[model samples]
Target: MNKNKNQYINREISWLSFNERVLQETADVNVPLIERMRFLGIFSNNLDEFFKVRYATVKRIVDAGKTGKSVLGGEKAKDILEEITTIVIKQQSKSLEILGAIEKELETENIFIIDENEVTDTQAVFLKSYFMQKVSPGLLTIILNDLREFPLLKDTAAYLAVKMVLINEVDGNENKENKYALIEIPKDIDRFVVLPNEGDKNYIILLDDLIRYSLRHIFTMFTFESISAHMIKITRDAELDMDNDLSKSFIEKISSSVEHRKISDPVRFVYDKNIADDTLSFLMDKMGIEETDSKIPGGKYHNRRDYMKFPSLGRKDLMYSKIDPLPVKDFSFEGSILEQIAQKDYLQYTPYHSFSYITKFLREAALDPQVRTIKLTVYRLASNSQVASSLINAAKNGKQVTVQIELQARFDEQANIEYAEQMQAEGVKLIFGVPGLKVHSKICVIEREENDKIKRYGFISTGNFNESTAKIYTDYTLFTAYSPLLKELNKVFDFFETTYKINKYKHLVVSPHYTKNVFIGLIDQEIKNAREGKDAFIKIKMNSFTSYKMVDKLYEASNAGVKIQLIVRGICCLVPGVKGMSENIEAISVVDKFLEHTRVFIFGNNGNSKVYISSADWMTRNLDFRVEVGCPIYDEDIKQELVDTFEISWNDNVKARMFSEQQDNAYRKNDKPKLRSQFAVYEYYQKKLNA
Candidate 1:
């Protein structure tokens, strides 16, 4: 097929549009004051990762002198790079404006985010003591002018570029020599330092400003006429470059790659717009940064991602009210959870439902005498993960526990490597995953002996088995003792051990072999139903959708009169609502307090519906490169509940942005009452519990 350029959005451009939605949260009036500031932080953090990974990839293509049109969704790689920089610069400027408005509103609430210039004498005394006692111990300062080679700047670490006009003359001439230095911001310290509260006001100082205030103290030995400091940061390419060293273990290779990322090629350089021209040029020249590289001019602060951890100041009124996680309806914590699942299927929707259910299940498996074996896949886990502890506990209890932990989970390599070593040390048999594919599936199956027969019980999820993220990331976990599905899930684990042999799954949708074909078959069925004048529709919720083949298939379905609704949270390359191409398709993205991380696919199979919760999106990597899983919803009640939740998100009038060809992330508005899906989902589950 000859692909048209206008048929789809470039993936990089779509990603920027998604980040813009996050930036919009900072400007929302209805959003809580402190939460808005944190949204700005989230936006900044998302941009850093974009540059480190996506932007870096395009830069590589440009460096290779390749057009890269076929891979980049019909756009040249060089053009995409330029477009990304332009879009990012504008978004950075807009974010600053939003930050300004949020600060003004915060002042009205008796909170002040004062900088170094605004520090009072009383605050100065407090700051100086805090700096000496807390900051000075960990601060890294480098004198740059005298060294022949400039020190390597850490990626994403903000630094203060200090330039001082020295008092002494240079080379016996009248010219004064300039001394330059770089001070690494101490990350161990809190970015927002809350000062002692006065009568009715709260004061907080950013760590950047506190360091700026202490520049004189930091350079007390040097005598200079004047001094100034500006914030600068560099983002490096984060792609892991694994070596072919037969002598090294897989863990060693991943650790080496992670360590190498510290000095990888720089993809972006951002500096304060108000910085001295001489200072900016000198630093760039010293670092060998070229004009062609992405150099973004920004406000005073460089790493605004720190704002994600902005102090709450005990102001419950300035943030969204925390919702207590509800118990899954009809699934009690009392007695054996395994016994309960053996009777019927249950779905645990996290944040709305307690994550403790996962931990509870694992802990039960670890202690149960009948449980003989447990196997699962590990992608990303929380720091001090209870999941890891439970796995270790299971292994220590003499149960044969096998873990296929992916050590290359992007910026999580080091953490996973550490967890892998810990689990291996505690007698958990470790599988490093298939050589060519990262195991991204979230599945667990335990074999328990009952009446001379081995009964299998398992759970499949749309998110990682991490407790910390479960509080804010909305996902679905299906607990079932159905032997048919559990048997196929065991086949997935078996594939991890023997990569060359292909496995067939009759129940669970396994990726890298069957997912694309299965989903295509499902879409084809819907297309046939629409042609037959039968009930035909499709609903999907995912983090991203960039597979062009799938987009074309959806377009074909839409052309055939199949009604399609998509809730994609990020990087949707498919252009929805286009006339002739996708007129019957509509898509929306919801960004609110909780991240919409679940991936659910519902297809109207003539009057009956087929529902699935998947670990994968329709992205190319997920479809053909990574090992992913999508399990069908067989239980009638659970399937209806999944449909109900997707409907709530689909009908969200607030916090939902429509995806269109214009790429302007416009919020969906209507005469109908405002319904925030995140809050409404909680209420839906609450009523279920009450019933």
Candidate 2:
């Protein structure tokens, strides 16, 4: 129990710790071989984003000559940046070792990941043809030495820095000259090139090595003594810089900013460790990368994120068994989904339950003649979104469709903008949210005319409405016909249009106005109950908890003897289990097959517990800057179900890692029987369906 004077951990450091937990999955033997590789990919992908956003923010602070202690959790910005770089270098080194181990284990399963030099003559014949046909046309090779201006490297794309020692015959005098070139890895082509199978064994080579082997063909015009290529990538600042131009629309501004991100300041520069020093220095100098920038030395591969799409190779035995998304216990798609909701509120826990219910609800509203209006919020959508199509369908019908599509949903901004344009063109009224606030709440309300009375039905969720993410992100979506709650939900959309008028919510907790106050009031009640010895406890599950004010209030409650349990998946700043500070609070994080994205809060109010599912984490932006919504579970059955699920997650002994003052991600173990919460949760739903 190492204790520090600081009450909260630095949010950036805590995020790195969370990613370390993801990296741990790559080394866990219980994880399937291919899945372990994919976990490595996930770790790498998470790091790339961290540098692009979080690391870049600290860099800006340092550049601005500000200490940034208040905003950065009592640490100076420069010191935090140095600590981050040190941690990332070590994590990158460990990930390479884990990758090597996974590759060895993959060999045991009759799968081989070989390099270019290891390619057989038979494979070489196939590789040459493959490169000439599929890889040659898309390749963009730039000769750097002769160009007056350096090319602008795309932040998302990795490149092969090629160094060739050429024999330049000037007037019959053979002079040795160094020629440098960069070959952009084609994003259109697959990174993993599967060779023809030899008997029962499978073989795959990365696209980088394939291009390495065919370099002579690409530069036939140059007479070179030797040639070599190594991977290099740059991650630029991804913060969208919006220009103040009243002439342009919001979508146009976002589109321009996204385009500008291609050449923004580089926050990170990653190169293969095997690359020559001169080549590394040359690329850095040409790209104007400073020594102060985060330069990470990686393995032969740069974008291991491509491993996330590593070919399945039709090997089911080497992968975890996929489970069929279950149906909600008593809810059915056979009849109208809206009608079923009118009876009692039901919860749809996705990745365990089918996401089809959401689509079905929208589809029904589109076709139902009695429905007069459909209103929803869009954050991120799938490539071909059935949700957007259903909204368009509703508009095509007589129903008035209103969608508050957020154009600033980070990395998915372009996709959201496209959907907004298409929806707007199709007669769906579009609201781009409030000027400063991002509409992150996942709520939809519909008005239906039943016997001359307009009845409201809607759902509030703790995750995005994207179909693709719903399959992997564990979220809670509550379907209800409760008029009071739905009416408040409508007020959220109303606030989007009329920004000056602040609306009051009795049934729903809306952010940017009342989320922090409401939550603090709940914590205060728990503290009072603890003082009176009335079974006081608070259980919260969220993706992140970084608000220092909320953290201090929880610490105050902990001192008052209120038992608090937190299951935060990432970026938790509060230090739990500290004597005289937070001895009564215990926190754990779960990183497993599915992402823990649901935000649930349960307060024991003297036998009458209060429960809520929200889109907001306990972060500053969520509490003060964004428009988020938290909905109460009024139905007894559904409230009990939420409690049951949270208990199961809290009881997880396998995947759960305790949060401590030391910041070590040690797994929670005990004498109790092993319960992997993810697996147990699916089983729990199965039992409910059977019972």
Per-residue lDDT for 225 in model 2?
Answer: 99
Which lDDT tens digits does candidate 2 get at residues 19-89?
A: 99999999999999899999988999999999999999999999999999999988999999999999999
Off by over 4 Å in 1: 1-5, 169-175
Instruction: Report the C-alpha lDDT of model 1 over 540-613, residue by residue, as the tens digit.
Output: 99999999999999999999999999999999999988788898999999999999999999999998999999
Residue 573 in candidate 2, Cα distance off native in Å: 0.2
lDDT at 437, model 2: 90
**lDDT scores of the candidates, listed in order:** 0.94, 0.94
Residue 404 miss distance in model 2 (angstroms): 0.3
TM-score of each: 0.99, 0.99
Stretches of candidate 2 above 4 Å error? 1-4
C-alpha RMSD values across all candidates: 1.3, 1.2
